[model samples]
Target chain A: MVTAALKEDLPGAGREISIEAVSHRFDLEGAPLPVLDDVSFTIEPGSFVALLGPSGCGKSTLLRLIAGLDHPASGAIRVDGAQVGAPDPSRILVFQDPTLFPWRTVRANVALGLEAQGTLKTEGHRIDAAINLVGLQGFDKAYPHQLSGGMAQRVALARALVNQPNVLLLDEPLGKLDSLTRLAMQTELVRLWQQSGLTAVLVTHDVEEALYLAQRVIVFGPRPAQVVADLTVDLPYPRHRGHPRIAELRHEALRHLGLEASW
Target chain B: MASIELPLEAGRAPAPVQGWTLLAALPWFAAVAVLLLVPDLTYQPLGRELALIWGAVGGVLTLLGLFGNRLGRVGRWSALRGPWLFAIGAASVLWTVVTAKTGWLPQPFFPTPQAMLEVFLYDYGKILHSAAFSIWLLAKGFFFGAIAGFLIGVGMGWSRAVSYWATPLLRYIGPLPATAWLPLAFFIFPSSGSASVFLIAFSTAFPVAVLTWSGIAAVNRDYYEIARTLGASPLFLIVKVAIPSALPHVFVGLFMGLSTSFAVLVVAEMLGVEAGLGWYLQWAQGWAAYANMYAALFVMAAMCSGLITLLFRIRDRVLVWQKGVVRW
Candidate 1:
């Protein structure tokens, strides 16, 4: 029930998102190929949710719809009772590839959102703060090519964070990182979400990652994806990898994804 | 009260004197010797004067080879080996030609290098004036063409409608050589100078526009999407994302345009211009002043290379982030 003014003024001022019967399709050689089919979900303000599904299940597409980067073929996605039409700085989407502008330094890339909004002169300090928050200190002048995969992703995170968005849509943000960096970044992501107190919807195929970070997991079906299962983790902070309860939840999530509990 | 004494080594290894330095100096020494010992077989030449100048050049090279290590940091004397060889070869060939020993290539057509050098010394003022005028014309044409081409290219890239209309026209008109329009250009413009300028500009514009269009078009869609999500306006996306991303391609276009402009400049100047390197070349050719023509050619080569090097320097500064990613 947060008002638009309140959301605009405050950092991490969460906005309740209610997506009703949203569907999306892509045109492939003059053919309408269904991607998302009648997907309905509600994300509470300041909550962490994970959209878990198999590859090609339209999880990322759903996030795109909510971010207003694309319009749903049918139904509507609303943030705080207002229908989403176009992309806004209030909802930032971080993609799998860092997608950082190669010509700009890390500092300049992080300042993009502010610069676009013409608020860089006033809120310039936030760029440095966001870089610091992402643990990318002392890399202000580093170019994208100079960075490691994890560091580049951290810069991408900082770029999104500098806007102080109410919702952060993550599409496999750490998918390209190595196992060790992935494990570390998972913890970092959780800490960032907790500190910011903003609604987060992460689209991941990793069952363990979903269980480790998100409070709610929305499993999606194959192709014309619809909600298969909606489960709550209800786990405590700093959740152990080998915890019996987490292991059981992992099995459940895998079952919903139509995969054997291989792990 | 007492000075501490350090033990001295019984044997010390001698610092290696670079042998390549001596190898580089041998050719220059030979060149100087040839110039001095060999008498000119031609009637109109002074071999002694040529020998003195070459002897000075050879002496300098020998000095560089001998004391190059003392130059500190700039002590890479081995790098000069190739240039040293080239100079020797060129000098020997020129000595043979001017000496008329072979009688294979006669004068008026193939003048001696010294004769060309004499032209440089005698007519330097005229050469300088022509060079200055050519540079001014080149600058005006290049800037105007580059600016116009960039604008048109950006528009074509940003809008489908603009691309739809302009793309076909560009394809049709872009490939035609700038020289082909000479007859029409002469009549359309008020003066030949302006027409020449227009021709230079026209030659430069096509490649720049075409490359820019492609550069902008080739930019990844993900960038536009990301920029849009971050609240970038259409203008912001075009300026910040599209332009910066397409800069590498724009530079490619600029390089192409620059080279073509030079070609067009020479042709344009030759046609009707009163002063320029190309004009000087035409005038020299008309009067059978082959030495002056060769001198002007040398000037044109140096100027073109200097300008290209300047462009590369600008590219390096502006595209600093693309350091190791893209190399010349």
Candidate 2:
């Protein structure tokens, strides 16, 4: 579904997004419009990638295709060497809102994905383990209304993780948080990712956050967004906020987007 | 410097057993005392037999109240609480016993306690049978109406086609009072007793249906969304989310429906049936047996209070999770 949306945005010709074929027309059309005219990328298993672009750019559209939430009108798409069609448990998507079931307790909400997959006979064990994983111990019976923003989102993370998905798709999951909570969540997310060895793809406009967490940051241009640059941050785990190499990479990525680089 | 001492558990006062117990008995004891004085003080054609019986019952209760238990005790055997209830019960008996003794009070007035107790003791077997019969009718109407209304209301709310087609007809038919359908029910059913039950059942069902539909519609949209996103099947969504979510409102409907059914059953029995409490009251009123009419009326009041209490207990038990949880 995501690939199809990306392909539809590509407009003019059926060229792969990274290749240069800006203008081509269907039968009687006179003008050729470019919206992601050509774009291509490959993501390795067990890798964390951030697709950062300005608003109205097709970066989100691209991630949707990769998540198998949408189909490409014309493009090749594969995950783990198999074609992506429908939403599978292997590729789980988490949205910005926690979307926890209000009626269910925190433990029940966290165990929901597993329940859907019919693996809920072990629900008792899984729920406690997941709640502990997200540092939400002693809150198993708390309702969603009783939780803080960060805590509620932790339940959502636990929900996604309980599915045991190979690929974790985050569509601006922390975009709605206050700055303090967002920073805390980012640190938590990185720690969880490191411990779990889960492959993650985050779609965010927060370039600093992107540079901080992801190993590879793919920059997309303004409109008809294609990969404008690919910068690799080779910082060690538990990266320092004021590291010179991190600052340089942020500057380079911002330079590509025509923005000042200083934090 | 003197050590300042604060009493632990300050302002945690003890329960007022004596006060409540005294308040409870005062009304009944006063009524009985008034009845006992009536024959000697008044020149009315007061029934001598009735006054004697009521005075005896009152004396027994006053004695129990005086010596049965302590004023400050809280248990059932405690003097204060037990006397208050005893006084009230004794007073009710005194009023029924004295109804025939006084012409100052209108016809159908409560008899003096003695007269009511005599009638109760002599005909207790018949009274119990008829009271039991009426209660059975009420239970049947309440259960049938509530269940039918709830299930159909859920159907109407859940299905657009059903709501569009059925609601208009229900609205039209529901407005016509259940009493209005009695003549038809009597004609269709083989017996008047069955007809009264049907009328009560049908009348009770309408409010239940309306309430159930409204309750189901009131469930949060987010619940449905979560269920859908979680890939819940249609059956799971309805049974797990929709029904439980709608239950609180549905219970209100059930209570209302049960009350309506009980009230309608009395009317139905008074009009057509000959065996229920309603019939007994009607029978006594027609014969100018004012004392029996009062007795039956008292029985009916007791039944209504008991049924309402029972329904409330059930509601409390079912919605126990909602205790202390505030919702708008």
Candidate 3:
């Protein structure tokens, strides 16, 4: 049943996302705190891009704007040439915390997007396939509190992919995991993105993680963020961790974030 | 081989000691002995009744002590067995000595335990009828109050405009006791029964509304944002996300409301209602039927505790995830 749903391709599954001159600000105690400053970037369909920055650099805010969870103070976000005004199932955001509804079981949490769109009855098998895709087949009945941090994040990934979203906006989705689990999940993430062929924008503070996974790494400057550097990771799939190229890219990313590149 | 044997030994249950079990039964025996040896100073003829009750209690205690270890994981009662037995026996003996023998407390006001028991045996029909009526009124009031409170709470929490208008009204009216409006309620309603139900409902509604509103309002913003990105409709957000997340608080409200409703139920019933535990209490008080009043009070305590225990069980089932997160 799950295989059939996996084989069934969504219509316009890999639509491109374009953000043109998008800017956003927050009102902090009667003062306007600008977060994003005319941030413009275009992601081709099925590409994995990482938005790397220091803490409080507004990278997460950019992802939120693209997700249509919040609107930009100026400029617009478009998906496949259509202006984005509201949150849609076609683009789902995975947060730093798994944020799986505590009351729901693993299967129910994965089925949330389908249930929200009212297509759960027809696309029910997709939920199973997505859970299977994330390697959570035997944990369908388990509640969120029962899961480990890494397992919970996997469920979150399954929840986003179950919708077969054209673009998956991730905000440090694995930032809370231990080092070993984080490394394992990095591989799992790359595999899921490769299999689904969906565009992904990951926001993270980790330099090596960005270099290890994303096809293109876009570095942002400090608060009132703007794109400071854009580097292409030409390293082959399953890139060697100890490789000099990865180290070089890490140094470059660190330099962009105004940190001293020790190595 | 030695290591495996060590693990096996660790897994095995500790041997049950019989001495503690025997010691636990001693208190119950003492209670029965006290009942048999002591004579009643008052000419109430409560001697046989006290002996019967204490003997039955001792028999039950002895049985429990003998087989408690066989109950396995649920044998927690065995841990405190001796202390519990001693406490119950001491309390029973003290109560009997004071009320029936010594008569330290005066008659009529402090009736013997046997007098209360006689009320249970003879006047049970009346007591039972009154309990039924009270429970019926409670069910009606609670159902209406809970539903109305939940809906209004959801509305106030979800919408700024609703909160803006309703909060002030709630603030002004909610703190006032439910019984305070009894005079007005009696005049407006068609019957005393309706008025009693209204008072119970009104008392219950405030806490439920206030708590539910706060619970909904306090829901993590991340959940709403995440749900929104997943294309959840407004209705789905409320019914699925908001309500479920706020349930722990709703239960808190329900608990507070339940206690308040019970309080209001008694007061409301005392206001010329033809039948109910509260009305029975009033009637008993008028004729100085102290024994009957004690019986009714005991019944009321048991019923209220039973209702509370039932609510806790339901909360445990529905909010199962909150088991380790929040402690009652």
TM-score of model 3's chain A: 0.95
Q: DockQ for all models, in order?
A: 0.80, 0.18, 0.76
Pairs that collide in candidate 3 are none
Cα lDDT tens digits for candidate 3, B19-119: 45556666656766766777766666455776777777676556656666577643446545667666777777777778877888788698887787788
Ranking by DockQ: 1, 3, 2
Instruction: Point to the candidate with the largest DockQ.
Output: 1
TM-score of each: 0.92, 0.71, 0.92
lDDT of 2 by residue, A1-263 (tens): 42243223211111111212222112327654445546777766667788888976766666566565556556657775577666565666777788776657888888776676577895446566567667899998888878888898999888776665667778888998999999988988887676556678888999889988898898989877778998888888787778889889988888888786444
Quote the positional error of residue A159 for candidate 3 in Å.
Answer: 0.6
lDDT of all predictions, in order shown? 0.85, 0.70, 0.86
Positional deviation of residue A135's Cα in model 2 after best superposition, in angstroms? 3.1
Candidates 1 and 2 compared: the better one by lDDT is 1
What is the alpha-carbon lDDT for the whole of candidate 3? 0.86
lDDT of 3 by residue, A97-216 (tens): 999999999999999989988999998988878888889989999999889999999999999988889999999999999999999999988877777778888999999899999999
